[model samples]
Target: MKTWKIIVLAAIVVVIDQITKFIVVSTMQIQQQIVVIPNFFSLFFIRNTGAAFSLFEGAQWFFYLTTVIALCLFVYFIKEIGDLNIWTGIGLGMAVGGMFGNFIDRLLFGSVVDFFKFVFGGYNFAIFNVADIGLTVGIGLVVIGLIVSEMKKKKTVAE
Candidate 1:
Protein backbone atom coordinates (compact mmCIF):
# COMPACT_ATOMS: atom_id res chain seq x y z
CA MET A 1 0.00 0.00 0.00
CA LYS A 2 1.05 3.59 -0.57
CA THR A 3 2.39 5.56 2.36
CA TRP A 4 -0.48 8.02 2.12
CA LYS A 5 -3.00 5.19 2.07
CA ILE A 6 -1.46 3.69 5.18
CA ILE A 7 -1.64 7.05 6.91
CA VAL A 8 -5.29 7.43 5.91
CA LEU A 9 -6.20 4.01 7.15
CA ALA A 10 -4.50 4.69 10.49
CA ALA A 11 -6.40 7.94 10.86
CA ILE A 12 -9.66 6.15 10.16
CA VAL A 13 -8.93 3.56 12.83
CA VAL A 14 -8.16 6.27 15.37
CA VAL A 15 -11.32 8.21 14.54
CA ILE A 16 -13.60 5.18 14.69
CA ASP A 17 -12.03 4.02 17.95
CA GLN A 18 -12.44 7.41 19.59
CA ILE A 19 -15.99 7.93 18.37
CA THR A 20 -17.10 4.55 19.65
CA LYS A 21 -15.49 5.22 23.01
CA PHE A 22 -17.29 8.55 23.25
CA ILE A 23 -20.64 6.93 22.52
CA VAL A 24 -20.04 4.19 25.01
CA VAL A 25 -19.09 6.60 27.75
CA SER A 26 -22.06 8.89 27.13
CA THR A 27 -24.68 6.18 26.69
CA MET A 28 -23.84 3.28 28.95
CA GLN A 29 -23.79 2.90 32.67
CA ILE A 30 -20.84 1.49 34.56
CA GLN A 31 -20.81 -2.29 34.24
CA GLN A 32 -24.16 -2.05 32.50
CA GLN A 33 -24.57 -4.70 29.85
CA ILE A 34 -27.18 -5.13 27.18
CA VAL A 35 -27.17 -8.48 25.48
CA VAL A 36 -26.79 -8.07 21.74
CA ILE A 37 -27.63 -11.68 20.92
CA PRO A 38 -28.50 -13.99 23.78
CA ASN A 39 -25.22 -14.95 25.52
CA PHE A 40 -22.76 -14.93 22.67
CA PHE A 41 -22.33 -11.18 22.48
CA SER A 42 -23.21 -7.97 24.27
CA LEU A 43 -22.44 -4.29 24.63
CA PHE A 44 -21.15 -3.51 28.08
CA PHE A 45 -19.57 -0.39 29.43
CA ILE A 46 -16.80 -0.06 31.98
CA ARG A 47 -13.69 1.93 32.67
CA ASN A 48 -10.59 -0.21 32.74
CA THR A 49 -8.45 1.11 35.52
CA GLY A 50 -5.58 -1.19 34.76
CA ALA A 51 -3.71 -2.62 31.79
CA ALA A 52 -4.89 -5.38 29.45
CA PHE A 53 -7.71 -7.53 30.84
CA SER A 54 -7.48 -5.45 33.97
CA LEU A 55 -4.43 -7.45 34.87
CA PHE A 56 -3.13 -4.93 37.36
CA GLU A 57 -6.58 -3.99 38.57
CA GLY A 58 -6.87 -0.80 40.60
CA ALA A 59 -3.32 0.25 39.89
CA GLN A 60 -3.83 3.32 37.77
CA TRP A 61 -0.16 4.10 37.71
CA PHE A 62 0.53 0.73 36.12
CA PHE A 63 -1.41 1.84 33.08
CA TYR A 64 0.41 5.13 32.88
CA LEU A 65 3.82 3.46 33.05
CA THR A 66 3.01 0.74 30.55
CA THR A 67 1.32 3.08 28.13
CA VAL A 68 4.46 5.13 27.86
CA ILE A 69 6.65 2.08 27.30
CA ALA A 70 4.23 0.61 24.79
CA LEU A 71 3.96 3.91 22.97
CA CYS A 72 7.73 4.11 22.77
CA LEU A 73 8.00 0.60 21.28
CA PHE A 74 5.14 1.39 18.94
CA VAL A 75 6.88 4.48 17.60
CA TYR A 76 10.26 2.82 17.43
CA PHE A 77 8.91 0.12 15.12
CA ILE A 78 7.00 2.54 12.92
CA LYS A 79 10.01 4.76 12.42
CA GLU A 80 12.41 1.90 11.74
CA ILE A 81 10.51 0.32 8.84
CA GLY A 82 12.84 0.31 5.79
CA ASP A 83 10.11 -0.66 3.36
CA LEU A 84 6.37 -0.65 3.78
CA ASN A 85 4.78 -3.96 2.94
CA ILE A 86 0.99 -3.72 2.86
CA TRP A 87 0.36 -5.99 5.80
CA THR A 88 3.27 -4.56 7.75
CA GLY A 89 2.00 -1.07 7.13
CA ILE A 90 -1.45 -2.03 8.30
CA GLY A 91 0.10 -3.63 11.36
CA LEU A 92 2.07 -0.54 12.29
CA GLY A 93 -0.87 1.73 11.58
CA MET A 94 -3.21 -0.23 13.78
CA ALA A 95 -0.67 -0.47 16.58
CA VAL A 96 0.31 3.18 16.57
CA GLY A 97 -3.28 4.43 16.33
CA GLY A 98 -4.56 2.04 18.95
CA MET A 99 -1.78 2.94 21.34
CA PHE A 100 -2.54 6.61 20.90
CA GLY A 101 -6.27 6.00 21.26
CA ASN A 102 -5.92 4.29 24.60
CA PHE A 103 -3.27 6.78 25.64
CA ILE A 104 -5.83 9.52 25.10
CA ASP A 105 -8.29 7.75 27.35
CA ARG A 106 -5.66 7.15 29.99
CA LEU A 107 -4.56 10.77 29.97
CA LEU A 108 -8.06 12.23 29.81
CA PHE A 109 -10.18 9.81 31.83
CA GLY A 110 -7.55 7.87 33.78
CA SER A 111 -8.98 4.71 32.25
CA VAL A 112 -9.70 3.14 28.88
CA VAL A 113 -13.28 3.02 27.67
CA ASP A 114 -14.46 -0.51 27.05
CA PHE A 115 -17.88 -1.50 25.75
CA PHE A 116 -17.86 -4.68 23.68
CA LYS A 117 -18.36 -7.92 25.54
CA PHE A 118 -18.40 -11.59 24.60
CA VAL A 119 -19.65 -14.48 26.69
CA PHE A 120 -20.58 -18.15 26.59
CA GLY A 121 -21.56 -20.93 28.95
CA GLY A 122 -20.67 -19.68 32.39
CA TYR A 123 -17.69 -17.84 31.01
CA ASN A 124 -17.47 -14.16 30.24
CA PHE A 125 -14.75 -12.04 28.73
CA ALA A 126 -13.67 -8.58 29.69
CA ILE A 127 -15.11 -5.60 27.86
CA PHE A 128 -13.05 -4.01 25.09
CA ASN A 129 -12.99 -0.94 22.89
CA VAL A 130 -12.20 -0.30 19.25
CA ALA A 131 -8.63 0.51 20.23
CA ASP A 132 -8.35 -3.11 21.29
CA ILE A 133 -9.45 -4.13 17.83
CA GLY A 134 -6.72 -2.07 16.27
CA LEU A 135 -4.15 -3.47 18.65
CA THR A 136 -5.21 -7.04 17.95
CA VAL A 137 -5.41 -6.64 14.19
CA GLY A 138 -2.05 -4.94 14.26
CA ILE A 139 -0.47 -7.89 16.02
CA GLY A 140 -2.11 -10.34 13.63
CA LEU A 141 -0.93 -8.39 10.59
CA VAL A 142 2.64 -8.26 11.78
CA VAL A 143 2.70 -11.99 12.42
CA ILE A 144 1.13 -12.76 9.06
CA GLY A 145 3.40 -10.38 7.23
CA LEU A 146 6.47 -11.97 8.76
CA ILE A 147 5.25 -15.43 7.86
CA VAL A 148 4.36 -14.50 4.30
CA SER A 149 7.56 -12.59 3.74
CA GLU A 150 9.59 -15.52 4.98
CA MET A 151 7.79 -17.87 2.62
CA LYS A 152 8.42 -15.55 -0.31
CA LYS A 153 12.11 -15.39 0.56
CA LYS A 154 12.29 -19.19 0.67
CA LYS A 155 10.52 -19.50 -2.68
CA THR A 156 12.93 -17.08 -4.34
CA VAL A 157 15.93 -18.95 -2.91
CA ALA A 158 14.60 -22.26 -4.23
CA GLU A 159 14.09 -20.81 -7.71
Candidate 2:
Protein backbone atom coordinates (compact mmCIF):
# COMPACT_ATOMS: atom_id res chain seq x y z
CA MET A 1 0.00 0.00 0.00
CA LYS A 2 1.04 3.55 -0.61
CA THR A 3 2.41 5.56 2.31
CA TRP A 4 -0.29 8.17 1.82
CA LYS A 5 -2.98 5.53 2.02
CA ILE A 6 -1.49 4.17 5.20
CA ILE A 7 -1.42 7.64 6.67
CA VAL A 8 -5.02 8.23 5.82
CA LEU A 9 -6.14 4.94 7.32
CA ALA A 10 -4.17 5.45 10.49
CA ALA A 11 -5.46 8.99 10.79
CA ILE A 12 -9.00 7.73 10.53
CA VAL A 13 -8.42 5.26 13.33
CA VAL A 14 -6.93 7.90 15.55
CA VAL A 15 -9.71 10.36 14.79
CA ILE A 16 -12.43 7.86 15.55
CA ASP A 17 -10.76 6.63 18.71
CA GLN A 18 -10.20 10.11 20.02
CA ILE A 19 -13.68 11.28 19.13
CA THR A 20 -15.33 8.41 20.97
CA LYS A 21 -13.17 8.91 24.00
CA PHE A 22 -13.91 12.60 23.97
CA ILE A 23 -17.61 11.91 23.96
CA VAL A 24 -17.30 9.50 26.86
CA VAL A 25 -15.28 11.93 28.90
CA SER A 26 -17.54 14.85 28.15
CA THR A 27 -20.81 13.11 28.91
CA MET A 28 -20.13 10.38 31.43
CA GLN A 29 -18.83 10.44 34.96
CA ILE A 30 -16.24 7.94 36.04
CA GLN A 31 -17.65 4.41 36.31
CA GLN A 32 -20.92 5.62 34.86
CA GLN A 33 -22.63 2.84 32.93
CA ILE A 34 -25.10 3.30 30.13
CA VAL A 35 -26.66 0.02 29.21
CA VAL A 36 -27.13 -0.45 25.49
CA ILE A 37 -28.21 -4.05 25.86
CA PRO A 38 -29.46 -5.37 29.15
CA ASN A 39 -27.21 -8.00 30.72
CA PHE A 40 -24.89 -8.02 27.76
CA PHE A 41 -23.11 -4.80 26.90
CA SER A 42 -22.81 -1.25 28.15
CA LEU A 43 -20.70 1.89 27.97
CA PHE A 44 -18.89 2.65 31.20
CA PHE A 45 -16.40 5.42 31.77
CA ILE A 46 -13.14 4.57 33.50
CA ARG A 47 -9.43 5.26 33.34
CA ASN A 48 -6.69 2.68 33.04
CA THR A 49 -3.41 3.59 34.62
CA GLY A 50 -1.74 0.40 33.58
CA ALA A 51 -1.19 -1.76 30.54
CA ALA A 52 -3.79 -3.88 28.76
CA PHE A 53 -6.27 -5.70 31.03
CA SER A 54 -5.27 -3.30 33.75
CA LEU A 55 -2.05 -5.07 34.44
CA PHE A 56 0.55 -3.25 36.54
CA GLU A 57 -1.98 -0.74 37.71
CA GLY A 58 -0.64 2.65 38.85
CA ALA A 59 2.67 2.05 37.11
CA GLN A 60 2.48 4.97 34.77
CA TRP A 61 6.19 5.21 34.07
CA PHE A 62 6.38 1.58 33.04
CA PHE A 63 3.64 2.12 30.49
CA TYR A 64 5.23 5.31 29.26
CA LEU A 65 8.51 3.56 28.66
CA THR A 66 6.89 0.59 26.97
CA THR A 67 4.76 2.80 24.78
CA VAL A 68 7.82 4.71 23.69
CA ILE A 69 9.51 1.45 22.81
CA ALA A 70 6.48 0.29 20.90
CA LEU A 71 6.31 3.57 19.01
CA CYS A 72 9.96 3.28 18.12
CA LEU A 73 9.39 -0.22 16.78
CA PHE A 74 6.49 1.02 14.71
CA VAL A 75 8.69 3.73 13.23
CA TYR A 76 11.41 1.21 12.45
CA PHE A 77 9.01 -1.22 10.82
CA ILE A 78 7.14 1.38 8.79
CA LYS A 79 9.82 1.41 6.11
CA GLU A 80 9.30 -2.28 5.43
CA ILE A 81 5.54 -1.78 4.99
CA GLY A 82 5.98 -1.10 1.28
CA ASP A 83 6.42 -4.81 0.66
CA LEU A 84 3.55 -5.93 2.91
CA ASN A 85 0.13 -7.08 1.75
CA ILE A 86 -3.02 -5.00 2.16
CA TRP A 87 -4.11 -6.80 5.30
CA THR A 88 -0.73 -6.29 6.86
CA GLY A 89 -0.90 -2.63 5.96
CA ILE A 90 -4.28 -2.34 7.57
CA GLY A 91 -3.03 -4.05 10.70
CA LEU A 92 -0.01 -1.85 10.96
CA GLY A 93 -2.10 1.26 10.46
CA MET A 94 -4.54 0.28 13.17
CA ALA A 95 -1.80 -0.69 15.60
CA VAL A 96 0.10 2.53 15.13
CA GLY A 97 -3.01 4.70 15.32
CA GLY A 98 -4.31 2.97 18.43
CA MET A 99 -0.91 3.07 20.07
CA PHE A 100 -0.67 6.77 19.54
CA GLY A 101 -4.19 7.38 20.71
CA ASN A 102 -3.52 5.75 24.09
CA PHE A 103 -0.04 7.19 24.22
CA ILE A 104 -1.50 10.67 23.99
CA ASP A 105 -3.90 9.94 26.82
CA ARG A 106 -1.14 8.52 28.96
CA LEU A 107 1.06 11.48 28.32
CA LEU A 108 -1.62 14.05 28.96
CA PHE A 109 -3.66 12.44 31.69
CA GLY A 110 -1.56 9.60 33.08
CA SER A 111 -4.31 7.17 32.16
CA VAL A 112 -6.21 5.71 29.22
CA VAL A 113 -9.95 6.19 28.95
CA ASP A 114 -12.12 3.07 28.65
CA PHE A 115 -15.86 2.86 28.08
CA PHE A 116 -17.04 -0.28 26.31
CA LYS A 117 -18.11 -3.25 28.42
CA PHE A 118 -19.27 -6.78 27.78
CA VAL A 119 -20.68 -9.12 30.39
CA PHE A 120 -21.56 -12.76 29.77
CA GLY A 121 -22.20 -15.68 32.08
CA GLY A 122 -21.31 -13.61 35.11
CA TYR A 123 -17.94 -12.79 33.62
CA ASN A 124 -17.17 -9.22 32.74
CA PHE A 125 -14.73 -8.82 29.94
CA ALA A 126 -12.28 -6.04 30.36
CA ILE A 127 -13.77 -2.63 29.81
CA PHE A 128 -11.99 -1.06 26.89
CA ASN A 129 -12.09 1.85 24.47
CA VAL A 130 -11.81 2.41 20.72
CA ALA A 131 -8.05 2.48 20.91
CA ASP A 132 -8.06 -0.87 22.64
CA ILE A 133 -10.40 -2.30 20.01
CA GLY A 134 -8.22 -1.12 17.16
CA LEU A 135 -5.12 -2.37 18.87
CA THR A 136 -6.56 -5.79 19.60
CA VAL A 137 -8.04 -6.30 16.15
CA GLY A 138 -4.92 -4.98 14.50
CA ILE A 139 -2.69 -7.35 16.40
CA GLY A 140 -4.97 -10.26 15.59
CA LEU A 141 -4.78 -9.43 11.89
CA VAL A 142 -1.03 -9.17 12.04
CA VAL A 143 -0.83 -12.58 13.70
CA ILE A 144 -3.15 -14.08 11.12
CA GLY A 145 -1.06 -12.61 8.35
CA LEU A 146 2.02 -14.15 9.85
CA ILE A 147 0.39 -17.53 10.17
CA VAL A 148 -0.84 -17.47 6.60
CA SER A 149 2.55 -16.43 5.32
CA GLU A 150 4.18 -19.28 7.19
CA MET A 151 1.70 -21.77 5.80
CA LYS A 152 2.33 -20.56 2.25
CA LYS A 153 6.05 -20.71 2.79
CA LYS A 154 5.79 -24.28 4.00
CA LYS A 155 3.65 -25.27 1.04
CA THR A 156 6.16 -23.76 -1.36
CA VAL A 157 8.99 -25.52 0.40
CA ALA A 158 7.13 -28.83 0.20
CA GLU A 159 6.47 -28.33 -3.49
Candidate 3:
Protein backbone atom coordinates (compact mmCIF):
# COMPACT_ATOMS: atom_id res chain seq x y z
CA MET A 1 0.00 0.00 0.00
CA LYS A 2 1.12 3.53 -0.68
CA THR A 3 2.11 5.77 2.21
CA TRP A 4 -0.48 8.37 1.33
CA LYS A 5 -3.24 5.78 1.41
CA ILE A 6 -2.09 4.62 4.81
CA ILE A 7 -2.14 8.17 6.07
CA VAL A 8 -5.62 8.73 4.72
CA LEU A 9 -6.84 5.58 6.42
CA ALA A 10 -5.32 6.73 9.68
CA ALA A 11 -7.02 10.08 9.33
CA ILE A 12 -10.36 8.37 8.81
CA VAL A 13 -9.96 6.36 11.99
CA VAL A 14 -9.03 9.44 13.94
CA VAL A 15 -12.05 11.33 12.68
CA ILE A 16 -14.41 8.52 13.56
CA ASP A 17 -12.89 8.04 16.99
CA GLN A 18 -12.96 11.70 17.84
CA ILE A 19 -16.51 12.12 16.64
CA THR A 20 -17.74 9.25 18.79
CA LYS A 21 -15.92 10.59 21.81
CA PHE A 22 -17.36 14.05 21.26
CA ILE A 23 -20.87 12.68 21.07
CA VAL A 24 -20.44 10.66 24.24
CA VAL A 25 -18.95 13.51 26.17
CA SER A 26 -21.64 15.91 25.03
CA THR A 27 -24.54 13.64 25.90
CA MET A 28 -23.47 11.85 29.06
CA GLN A 29 -22.16 12.82 32.44
CA ILE A 30 -19.24 11.12 34.08
CA GLN A 31 -20.24 7.80 35.66
CA GLN A 32 -23.46 7.79 33.68
CA GLN A 33 -24.70 4.55 32.20
CA ILE A 34 -27.15 4.06 29.34
CA VAL A 35 -27.74 0.40 29.03
CA VAL A 36 -28.05 -0.86 25.49
CA ILE A 37 -28.26 -4.60 25.93
CA PRO A 38 -29.49 -5.16 29.43
CA ASN A 39 -26.86 -7.42 31.00
CA PHE A 40 -24.49 -7.49 28.05
CA PHE A 41 -23.49 -4.01 27.02
CA SER A 42 -23.95 -0.31 27.73
CA LEU A 43 -22.57 3.16 27.18
CA PHE A 44 -20.87 4.13 30.41
CA PHE A 45 -19.00 7.40 30.65
CA ILE A 46 -15.73 7.69 32.55
CA ARG A 47 -12.43 9.48 32.25
CA ASN A 48 -9.43 7.18 32.42
CA THR A 49 -6.25 8.76 33.68
CA GLY A 50 -4.11 5.77 32.91
CA ALA A 51 -3.31 3.19 30.26
CA ALA A 52 -5.30 0.10 29.51
CA PHE A 53 -7.40 -1.25 32.35
CA SER A 54 -6.55 1.93 34.27
CA LEU A 55 -2.95 0.89 34.82
CA PHE A 56 -0.53 3.51 36.10
CA GLU A 57 -3.35 5.82 37.04
CA GLY A 58 -2.66 9.56 37.05
CA ALA A 59 0.78 9.26 35.44
CA GLN A 60 0.30 11.87 32.76
CA TRP A 61 3.97 12.56 32.09
CA PHE A 62 4.69 8.89 31.57
CA PHE A 63 2.02 8.59 28.91
CA TYR A 64 3.08 11.77 27.16
CA LEU A 65 6.68 10.65 26.94
CA THR A 66 5.80 7.14 25.82
CA THR A 67 3.33 8.34 23.21
CA VAL A 68 5.89 10.66 21.72
CA ILE A 69 8.43 7.85 21.56
CA ALA A 70 5.93 5.47 20.00
CA LEU A 71 4.89 8.01 17.40
CA CYS A 72 8.52 8.57 16.45
CA LEU A 73 9.06 4.84 16.14
CA PHE A 74 6.00 4.51 13.93
CA VAL A 75 7.26 7.20 11.62
CA TYR A 76 10.70 5.64 11.49
CA PHE A 77 9.31 2.21 10.73
CA ILE A 78 7.08 3.47 7.94
CA LYS A 79 9.96 5.26 6.30
CA GLU A 80 12.30 2.28 6.64
CA ILE A 81 9.74 -0.17 5.33
CA GLY A 82 8.38 1.58 2.31
CA ASP A 83 5.51 0.24 0.25
CA LEU A 84 4.04 -2.00 2.89
CA ASN A 85 1.64 -4.85 2.18
CA ILE A 86 -2.08 -4.08 2.46
CA TRP A 87 -2.60 -5.71 5.82
CA THR A 88 0.50 -4.20 7.41
CA GLY A 89 -0.20 -0.74 6.07
CA ILE A 90 -3.81 -0.74 7.15
CA GLY A 91 -2.90 -2.12 10.54
CA LEU A 92 -0.19 0.44 11.12
CA GLY A 93 -2.44 3.24 9.99
CA MET A 94 -5.22 2.22 12.35
CA ALA A 95 -2.79 1.91 15.23
CA VAL A 96 -1.38 5.35 14.54
CA GLY A 97 -4.83 6.87 14.32
CA GLY A 98 -5.90 5.24 17.58
CA MET A 99 -2.77 6.42 19.37
CA PHE A 100 -3.34 9.99 18.21
CA GLY A 101 -7.01 9.89 19.15
CA ASN A 102 -6.22 9.10 22.75
CA PHE A 103 -3.30 11.47 22.71
CA ILE A 104 -5.62 14.29 21.69
CA ASP A 105 -7.93 13.50 24.58
CA ARG A 106 -5.02 13.45 27.00
CA LEU A 107 -3.74 16.77 25.74
CA LEU A 108 -7.15 18.43 25.89
CA PHE A 109 -8.71 16.86 28.98
CA GLY A 110 -5.83 15.18 30.86
CA SER A 111 -7.61 11.87 30.47
CA VAL A 112 -9.29 9.58 27.93
CA VAL A 113 -13.06 9.61 27.57
CA ASP A 114 -14.32 6.06 27.69
CA PHE A 115 -17.91 4.87 27.21
CA PHE A 116 -18.28 1.42 25.73
CA LYS A 117 -18.78 -1.27 28.37
CA PHE A 118 -19.23 -4.98 28.20
CA VAL A 119 -20.21 -7.64 30.73
CA PHE A 120 -20.09 -11.29 29.95
CA GLY A 121 -21.20 -13.95 32.42
CA GLY A 122 -20.74 -11.54 35.34
CA TYR A 123 -17.22 -10.63 34.25
CA ASN A 124 -17.08 -6.90 33.66
CA PHE A 125 -14.62 -6.09 30.91
CA ALA A 126 -12.58 -2.96 30.73
CA ILE A 127 -14.42 0.15 29.55
CA PHE A 128 -12.97 1.39 26.28
CA ASN A 129 -13.56 3.67 23.30
CA VAL A 130 -13.23 3.66 19.52
CA ALA A 131 -9.54 4.44 19.72
CA ASP A 132 -8.92 1.35 21.81
CA ILE A 133 -10.83 -0.71 19.29
CA GLY A 134 -8.65 0.58 16.47
CA LEU A 135 -5.49 -0.12 18.42
CA THR A 136 -6.49 -3.65 19.34
CA VAL A 137 -7.76 -4.65 15.91
CA GLY A 138 -4.86 -2.99 14.12
CA ILE A 139 -2.28 -4.76 16.27
CA GLY A 140 -4.04 -8.05 15.73
CA LEU A 141 -3.94 -7.54 11.96
CA VAL A 142 -0.29 -6.62 12.05
CA VAL A 143 0.51 -9.78 13.97
CA ILE A 144 -1.47 -11.91 11.58
CA GLY A 145 0.16 -10.29 8.57
CA LEU A 146 3.62 -10.88 9.98
CA ILE A 147 2.85 -14.49 10.71
CA VAL A 148 1.55 -15.09 7.23
CA SER A 149 4.51 -13.35 5.66
CA GLU A 150 6.92 -15.43 7.73
CA MET A 151 5.13 -18.62 6.77
CA LYS A 152 5.41 -17.76 3.09
CA LYS A 153 9.12 -17.08 3.44
CA LYS A 154 9.69 -20.44 5.18
CA LYS A 155 7.71 -22.25 2.52
CA THR A 156 9.72 -20.64 -0.29
CA VAL A 157 13.00 -21.51 1.42
CA ALA A 158 11.94 -25.11 1.96
CA GLU A 159 10.84 -25.57 -1.66
Candidate 4:
Protein backbone atom coordinates (compact mmCIF):
# COMPACT_ATOMS: atom_id res chain seq x y z
CA MET A 1 0.00 0.00 0.00
CA LYS A 2 2.97 2.27 -0.31
CA THR A 3 2.38 5.31 -2.52
CA TRP A 4 5.29 4.47 -4.78
CA LYS A 5 4.09 0.91 -5.25
CA ILE A 6 0.61 2.12 -6.02
CA ILE A 7 2.01 4.51 -8.60
CA VAL A 8 4.05 1.73 -10.16
CA LEU A 9 0.98 -0.47 -10.43
CA ALA A 10 -0.90 2.32 -12.13
CA ALA A 11 1.97 2.87 -14.50
CA ILE A 12 1.99 -0.78 -15.47
CA VAL A 13 -1.71 -0.75 -16.13
CA VAL A 14 -1.42 2.34 -18.28
CA VAL A 15 1.41 0.79 -20.26
CA ILE A 16 -0.43 -2.42 -20.92
CA ASP A 17 -3.63 -0.60 -21.77
CA GLN A 18 -1.93 1.72 -24.20
CA ILE A 19 0.00 -1.11 -25.84
CA THR A 20 -3.13 -3.12 -26.44
CA LYS A 21 -4.87 -0.06 -27.88
CA PHE A 22 -1.93 0.64 -30.12
CA ILE A 23 -1.95 -2.89 -31.46
CA VAL A 24 -5.65 -2.78 -32.12
CA VAL A 25 -5.46 0.54 -33.88
CA SER A 26 -2.55 -0.53 -35.99
CA THR A 27 -3.85 -3.93 -36.97
CA MET A 28 -7.59 -3.65 -37.17
CA GLN A 29 -9.74 -1.61 -39.47
CA ILE A 30 -12.66 0.38 -38.17
CA GLN A 31 -15.79 -1.70 -37.55
CA GLN A 32 -13.81 -4.90 -38.03
CA GLN A 33 -14.81 -7.99 -36.13
CA ILE A 34 -12.73 -11.06 -35.48
CA VAL A 35 -14.69 -13.73 -33.67
CA VAL A 36 -12.82 -15.36 -30.83
CA ILE A 37 -15.82 -17.44 -29.86
CA PRO A 38 -18.86 -17.71 -32.00
CA ASN A 39 -21.85 -15.85 -30.57
CA PHE A 40 -19.99 -15.26 -27.34
CA PHE A 41 -16.89 -13.12 -27.64
CA SER A 42 -14.92 -11.28 -30.29
CA LEU A 43 -12.50 -8.48 -31.05
CA PHE A 44 -14.48 -5.77 -32.71
CA PHE A 45 -12.81 -2.47 -33.52
CA ILE A 46 -14.79 0.67 -32.83
CA ARG A 47 -14.36 4.30 -31.95
CA ASN A 48 -16.50 5.77 -29.24
CA THR A 49 -16.89 9.50 -28.83
CA GLY A 50 -18.95 9.17 -25.74
CA ALA A 51 -18.71 7.77 -22.24
CA ALA A 52 -18.81 4.11 -21.17
CA PHE A 53 -21.16 1.87 -23.16
CA SER A 54 -20.95 4.63 -25.78
CA LEU A 55 -23.63 6.76 -24.23
CA PHE A 56 -23.95 10.48 -25.00
CA GLU A 57 -22.53 9.95 -28.46
CA GLY A 58 -20.61 13.11 -29.33
CA ALA A 59 -19.51 14.84 -26.19
CA GLN A 60 -15.84 15.31 -26.86
CA TRP A 61 -15.32 18.42 -24.76
CA PHE A 62 -17.33 16.97 -21.94
CA PHE A 63 -15.05 13.95 -21.71
CA TYR A 64 -11.88 16.03 -21.79
CA LEU A 65 -13.13 18.20 -18.96
CA THR A 66 -14.29 15.20 -16.96
CA THR A 67 -10.95 13.45 -17.31
CA VAL A 68 -9.17 16.48 -15.94
CA ILE A 69 -11.59 16.70 -13.04
CA ALA A 70 -11.25 13.00 -12.29
CA LEU A 71 -7.47 13.18 -12.32
CA CYS A 72 -7.58 16.08 -9.95
CA LEU A 73 -9.85 14.14 -7.63
CA PHE A 74 -7.56 11.12 -7.81
CA VAL A 75 -4.60 13.20 -6.72
CA TYR A 76 -6.52 14.68 -3.84
CA PHE A 77 -7.77 11.25 -2.72
CA ILE A 78 -4.29 9.73 -2.94
CA LYS A 79 -3.00 12.36 -0.54
CA GLU A 80 -5.71 11.39 1.93
CA ILE A 81 -5.28 7.61 1.46
CA GLY A 82 -2.70 6.91 4.11
CA ASP A 83 -2.31 3.38 5.52
CA LEU A 84 -4.92 1.86 3.24
CA ASN A 85 -4.65 -1.83 2.25
CA ILE A 86 -3.23 -3.31 -0.93
CA TRP A 87 -6.63 -3.63 -2.51
CA THR A 88 -7.24 0.04 -1.99
CA GLY A 89 -3.89 0.87 -3.45
CA ILE A 90 -4.60 -1.35 -6.43
CA GLY A 91 -7.92 0.35 -6.90
CA LEU A 92 -6.38 3.78 -6.83
CA GLY A 93 -3.73 2.77 -9.29
CA MET A 94 -6.07 1.08 -11.70
CA ALA A 95 -8.54 3.91 -11.62
CA VAL A 96 -5.89 6.45 -12.40
CA GLY A 97 -4.34 4.23 -15.07
CA GLY A 98 -7.65 3.67 -16.77
CA MET A 99 -8.46 7.34 -16.69
CA PHE A 100 -5.16 8.22 -18.24
CA GLY A 101 -5.49 5.46 -20.82
CA ASN A 102 -8.82 6.71 -22.10
CA PHE A 103 -7.84 10.32 -21.71
CA ILE A 104 -4.90 9.72 -24.02
CA ASP A 105 -7.23 8.51 -26.74
CA ARG A 106 -9.59 11.38 -26.26
CA LEU A 107 -6.77 13.88 -26.45
CA LEU A 108 -5.08 12.41 -29.48
CA PHE A 109 -7.89 10.91 -31.51
CA GLY A 110 -11.08 12.61 -30.33
CA SER A 111 -12.43 9.20 -29.31
CA VAL A 112 -11.58 5.95 -27.53
CA VAL A 113 -10.63 2.77 -29.33
CA ASP A 114 -12.73 -0.19 -28.30
CA PHE A 115 -12.11 -3.79 -29.33
CA PHE A 116 -13.53 -6.42 -27.01
CA LYS A 117 -17.11 -7.51 -27.55
CA PHE A 118 -19.49 -9.95 -25.94
CA VAL A 119 -22.85 -11.43 -26.90
CA PHE A 120 -25.28 -13.02 -24.50
CA GLY A 121 -28.81 -14.30 -25.12
CA GLY A 122 -29.02 -12.54 -28.48
CA TYR A 123 -27.85 -9.25 -27.02
CA ASN A 124 -24.82 -7.53 -28.45
CA PHE A 125 -22.89 -6.12 -25.56
CA ALA A 126 -21.15 -2.78 -25.88
CA ILE A 127 -17.61 -2.94 -27.24
CA PHE A 128 -14.91 -2.00 -24.79
CA ASN A 129 -11.16 -2.00 -24.24
CA VAL A 130 -8.52 -2.75 -21.61
CA ALA A 131 -8.96 0.66 -20.03
CA ASP A 132 -12.63 -0.05 -19.44
CA ILE A 133 -11.74 -3.33 -17.76
CA GLY A 134 -9.30 -1.60 -15.47
CA LEU A 135 -11.78 1.13 -14.64
CA THR A 136 -14.61 -1.28 -13.80
CA VAL A 137 -12.49 -3.68 -11.78
CA GLY A 138 -10.69 -0.84 -10.08
CA ILE A 139 -13.96 0.77 -9.06
CA GLY A 140 -15.12 -2.59 -7.69
CA LEU A 141 -11.98 -2.91 -5.57
CA VAL A 142 -12.46 0.59 -4.22
CA VAL A 143 -16.02 -0.24 -3.24
CA ILE A 144 -14.83 -3.40 -1.49
CA GLY A 145 -12.24 -1.40 0.39
CA LEU A 146 -14.85 1.09 1.50
CA ILE A 147 -17.11 -1.71 2.74
CA VAL A 148 -14.26 -3.33 4.66
CA SER A 149 -13.29 -0.01 6.18
CA GLU A 150 -16.85 0.61 7.29
CA MET A 151 -17.11 -2.84 8.86
CA LYS A 152 -13.92 -2.29 10.80
CA LYS A 153 -15.20 1.04 12.07
CA LYS A 154 -18.48 -0.52 13.19
CA LYS A 155 -16.66 -3.34 14.92
CA THR A 156 -14.47 -0.90 16.82
CA VAL A 157 -17.48 1.17 17.89
CA ALA A 158 -19.32 -1.94 19.06
CA GLU A 159 -16.34 -3.28 20.98
Model 3's TM-score against the true structure: 0.96
Q: Give the per-residue lDDT digits (tens) of candidate 2, residues 40-121.
A: 9999999999876799999988878887898788667767645666666777778878888888899889999999999997
Off by over 4 Å in 2: 154-159
Model 3 ranges with Cα > 4 A deviation: none
lDDT of 3 by residue, 57-147 (tens): 9999998999899889878988998877778888888988999999999999999999999999999999999999988888887778778
* By lDDT: ranked, best first: 3, 4, 2, 1
Q: What is the lDDT of residue 81 in candidate 4?
A: 68
Q: In candidate 3, list every pair of residues with a backbone clash.
A: none
42-139 per-residue lDDT for model 1 (tens digits)? 99888887766788877777767876898777556656765667788888788767877887888898888988898868798777888888988988
- lDDT of each residue in 18-133, candidate 4, tens digit only: 99999999999999999999999999999999987778789888888888998898778878867677677788889888888998998899899999999997999888888888
Cα-lDDT of candidate 4: 0.87
User: Which pairs clash inside model 2?
Assistant: none
TM-score of each: 0.87, 0.91, 0.96, 0.95
